[model samples]
Target: MKITLITTGSTADKGPRKVAEYLQKYNHKLEVIFYNENELRQTLSKCKNTDLIVVSANVATHKRASLLIQHLKKLKRPTAYAGIYAALHPEECIKETDLVITAKPAETILELANRLENFQRIADIENLRLKFNKKEIIKNA
Candidate 1:
């Protein structure tokens, strides 16, 4: 699957990079963009054509994450949130993203990539907390 990994300047978290490496091991295409590296519009536009977008935001930039999520939500893009804040606060993250990645997420994300590639249901993937259902946000195991 083609994925766009985004992170804010303040956090500069390595989570996205690690996931990029892991996904690449499985031959998945990935593009990583740091907010400080390019103009917001340019970085965000990259997400539009990708299969999925993974935004990693810690405590310092959940607000920025929310804004980005809101914008993506408008475009009807499939997005997931990662990092400590997302895992710790799935409730809040769900309001912004279609899913929340938590725990040892790399493998689960690989499953998600494959499922997405196959046009299969991704909501039941382990370690993926899905918010697509309004009745309940699937929690991490």
Candidate 2:
């Protein structure tokens, strides 16, 4: 999966990078693109193969998250959010996310890595289902 991770604050960047490095051990094909708010918006417009988007809660109360959500909704890509405010402001995050995983700096990276792996697994299953359905249709045709 190609994941675009948007970092709202300096703190958010470290966790995603660590998670990406950890995930690389098991799935080297998983590509992560780190972006700050401005870069993320611009990249979103051009990215064609993005499978998922992860935003950090450091963006709390900022319009960046809302704007990104609108774009994601239009693109129909699955999204997730991770950071301190995720749980406390679940309603806000949930509006834009398929999953919200809350964690502090201590375990944030590890938790995000695990959640991303699960997301990948689910995507794989969905892809296989689509492939199987297409095969069935071809056979019947």
Candidate 3:
């Protein structure tokens, strides 16, 4: 499976970067791209081969996160949000993302990726919030 990690902000945060680094051990293809709004469209256009997208941002990059999620939604791709902003605002993040990843995301994201690839159950992933069904949103506590 191919995964894209789009980190958006004026300054980079450590958490998402660490998670990105950790994910490489799983041997799945991964691309970590630092995105500024100016070049976002161009960057995202190159993501045609991505199986999943993980948008990483913080409070300072709220606008970036929102913008990226909007475009990702338009593309109808499976998308998730990582880092502090998503953790702090799972409700808001879930509105835009297919998955809202809270807390440390590497292991959870790996599990999600593996499940997504193999068609295993996804709702059981730790710290991940998403819809249980179209009628209801599942927010993990």
Candidate 4:
């Protein structure tokens, strides 16, 4: 799956980088992009087909991270927040994201990805059922 990690502040932040590295190690096929806050537009553009978005609030103000999350929400994608700020203010992060990773961010994100993949599969099955029912109705008519 394609995962985007957007960090608040510069690339000097180690928290998000570590998360990205961990994720890469977990699944080499995973396409992960680490972007700074200033690259919001580029991140949004690349997120067209992204499966998940993880925002890191390392050393930046909560307000800045919140605003970034809000912008990402407009894309209607599943978003997760991490880093110390997220851990300290999970409630605030939760307000803007689907999940807040207080610890073991890489593991939590992988689990969430699995759940989402399964959910999509279930939805596909349901759609097939609907299509089959429609065909049966047409045959009866």
TM-score of every candidate: 0.88, 0.59, 0.90, 0.72
| TM-score-sorted candidate list, best first | 3, 1, 4, 2
lDDT of 1 by residue, 1-141 (tens): 798888864545677788889999999999988865346678767777888887777887788877877777655667888777787887888777778887676787788888989999876788788865666667755
Q: Is candidate 1 or candidate 4 better by TM-score?
A: 1
Q: How much RMSD separates candidate 1 from the native structure?
A: 2.1
* Alpha-carbon lDDT, every model: 0.78, 0.51, 0.80, 0.63
Q: Per-residue lDDT for 55-128 in model 2, tens only?
A: 65564433565566656666766566655556456555555545555444224333334555566333222101
In terms of lDDT, the poorest run of 10 residues in model 3 is 9-18
Q: Which prediction has the highest TM-score against the true structure?
A: 3
Spell out the clash pairs found in candidate 3: none
Tell me the spans in candidate 1 whose CA falls farther than 4 Å from its real position: 9-12, 36-38
Range of the 10 consecutive residues with the lowest summed lDDT in candidate 2: 132-141
lDDT of 2 at 69: 61
TM-score of 2: 0.59
Candidate whose lDDT is highest: 3
Off by over 4 Å in 2: 28-37, 59-62, 104-141
Query: What is the C-alpha RMSD, rounded to one decimal, of candidate 2?
Result: 9.7
Report the Cα lDDT for candidate 2: 0.51
lDDT of model 3 at residue 17?
A: 67
